[model samples]
Target: MGGSPHTLCVPAGCSSSDDYTVPDALCGVTVGSEPLAPLLPDGEKSVCSVSVDKKQAVYVTDGVTDAETDPVAVQRDALARMGNPQKAAVGDDARIADQGGVAVGVCTYQGRRQKFVTLVDLTSNHPVPKRTADRRKALESFLRAYLPKAMEAKGCRK
Candidate 1:
């Protein structure tokens, strides 16, 4: 195999939580809502918009609520609402709700102590039923597309 050896990157001085820096803005991450099409109406096309709140740690698309105090708390709350979330093979740590309406992904970036957390919600208007395999897959697909871009923007090793 003709390939270059890649060196493993380890964060320096990563002992304290304060050493990690959270991303101030996520609007720079380029992502489309196309992966989310299946979650919406057949004829409807939804545009993904980032919240401009400076308090938010990452780019929170429309459907996702901005983190007010703690991102980890937000993640815990989202997972709680999911009832039962299936582990996703997306980012560092990810979970997709059984109903396919909610998905949360977490990725740790280089030089930042704070991990980038993202949430996708499709159950805003109505309650999503349980055990929706297809919907869960769709949510997984969306995270597949969204997480990489967001991670790259945050300077994660590809």
Candidate 2:
């Protein structure tokens, strides 16, 4: 797939959490494989944006049934990921827009880290109140593949 320079990529061996090396600057990233569902249309994806550093980890999902994710809880978890008892930061509003049937979520863990953005596609079927475990896996996979590129991209962020 062709995209702008800011388009990031995740690395291999990121199938699990402990295997990931959080970007020194950007902790946010898009993870997952392509849609595995026969009913799901091509091009659209169940995107999840995860920002994790040595200080914290933030997981955001869109195009799923759970938009009720508590930012406070996420912040706590993110901090725990880095073994930091203090909460670093949390995006009060994190989501992907369903643009004309294409659902996409983006997360830019700016300020706390360096500068980078992770865009995830959840589905082509607009926003709905439902989620599946498969989608979660897809998100993790995609982010694991591309988070590093986003975090390390120089001159991409403002």
Candidate 3:
């Protein structure tokens, strides 16, 4: 988008004739002149125009997506892959935690299997650990049920 006009300011109390032409990089683009062509219409084509401010507000670029590496789905998948639930702990994998922060956590069982969960915290810094024995079992069951659904919702799993 075109920017605002460049101004050449004279020294304090100095006349315009005494002002120096600032470097092009320092001075902004001139205003009220014809805008560069791609922005303008060519030939008989009807052109629709929006102001720079309005254009900025209306337009945006598309984002990229990945299936296996979607943070939340990956975490759930990783946890399911690990198999054991008792050994799971928060912030276990430096790489995943670094990428997703507390949005990821690991759950290990009997030190044999591990599972990861993502987006367990919408805002909190830590996942709420299952404390009691029965609660842990319940939590594990909940993860098994919910993880697949969460992955599917993110379009990361079939």
User: All models: lDDT?
Assistant: 0.46, 0.29, 0.27
Q: Root-mean-square deviation of each candidate, in angstroms?
A: 16.2, 15.9, 22.9
Lowest-lDDT window of 10 residues in candidate 1? 1-10
Query: Worst lDDT window (10 residues) for model 3?
Result: 55-64
Error of 3 at 131 (Å): 6.6
1-158, model 3: which lDDT tens digit per residue? 12322234333422533222221110121221221221221122111221222221111011113322344443455434323333333333211221112123233333323333333211112212212343334333333333444333333322
The lDDT of model 2 is 0.29
lDDT of 2 by residue, 35-118 (tens): 222112222112322222221123323221133444334434432432223221112222222211112123333432222333
Model 3 misplaced stretches (Cα beyond 4 Å): 1-85, 88-131
Compute the lDDT for candidate 1: 0.46
- TM-score for candidate 3, residues paired by index: 0.24
Best by lDDT: 1
TM-score of each: 0.52, 0.27, 0.24
C-alpha positional error of residue 62 in candidate 1 after TM-score superposition, expressed in Å: 11
Which regions in candidate 1 have their CA more than 4 angstroms from the true location? Answer: 1-28, 32-34, 43-74, 99-110, 127-131, 156-158
